[model samples]
Target: MPNRRGLPQKWCHQELEVNEMAFSHRGNMTECKWKDKRDVYFLTTKHTASWTEVTVKAKGGPTKEIKPDRTLDYNLSKIGVNSNDQCICIILLIEEKPMKWWKKMFFHLMAHAMVNT
Candidate 1:
C-alpha cells in the first residue's frame, strides 16, 4: 500500500519472507527503503539508484540477497561518522548549555573541526 508520497505505509518484519525494497528520487535526493528484520529507510544525495547482492546466513545456510546499494553504502559510511559523533559527545565533553544560536553553532563547528583534525 502506497501513501500520499507513493511510498509504502508500513512493512511487517515478522511476516517478511523476502527482502522488499522501494525507492524514490527527486533532483539530487534519493530515498530508499529495504525491509529485512525491520524496515530501514535511507536518504542520500551521493548514491544512485542501484542494487547489489549481500550474503546472509539463514536456516538453510548462506544465501545471496539483493538490496539497495545505497543502503549498504550508507551503513558502511556511517560507522566513521557515528564514531566521530560519539567522540565529540564523550571526549570533547561539550554539553548543551543555554547560549545564542550563533554561539552554539560556532562551538559545534569548532568541536567537529577539533575532532576531525
Candidate 2:
C-alpha cells in the first residue's frame, strides 16, 4: 500500500522499477511504465493498455520508440485540455471592458466552463 495517491511516497526519492505495470479495480488504480533516458510511470483507468511501436527522431535520425498504448491514449486524450488552454489564451488576448476584478474572473471562469463542456 503506497498512499491515498496510489504511488509510493518514495517515488520522488527513487525511480520506480522498469517494465512494472499494475492495475486494481478495487482501488481504481492503474500504472503504466515507459522510458527514454529515464523511467516514467503513468496511471490511468485503462485496462486495455499495451505497448505501441512508434518511430522517434533520435539524435541521429528516426528511431524506434516503444511507448505504452495507455500513454498514447493519454496523449491523444489531452487534445481537449490543450484546446481549452489555447481557447483561454485566445479569450484572454482580446481586450475587454474595464470592470471589477471579480467580474473579469467570472467571465474567465464562465468561458473555461463553456470550453470544458
Provide the TM-score for each candidate, comma-separated.
0.49, 0.56
Question: Candidate 2's C-alpha lDDT?
Answer: 0.66
Q: Which candidate number maximizes lDDT?
A: 1
Tens-digit lDDT track for model 1 on 1-117?
A: 223463334432324445877677767888776677776767678887789889988999999998888767768989999989997777445555688888877777888888899
Best candidate (score: TM-score): 2
Report the lDDT tens digits of candidate 2 across residue range 1-117: 234465655454555444444333335566644454566666676554567788878799998766678767778899878988999878866746688998889878978887777
* Per-candidate RMSD, Å: 6.5, 5.1
Candidate 2 vs. true structure, TM-score: 0.56
What are the runs in model 1 whose C-alpha is more than 4 Å off?
Answer: 1-17, 78-117
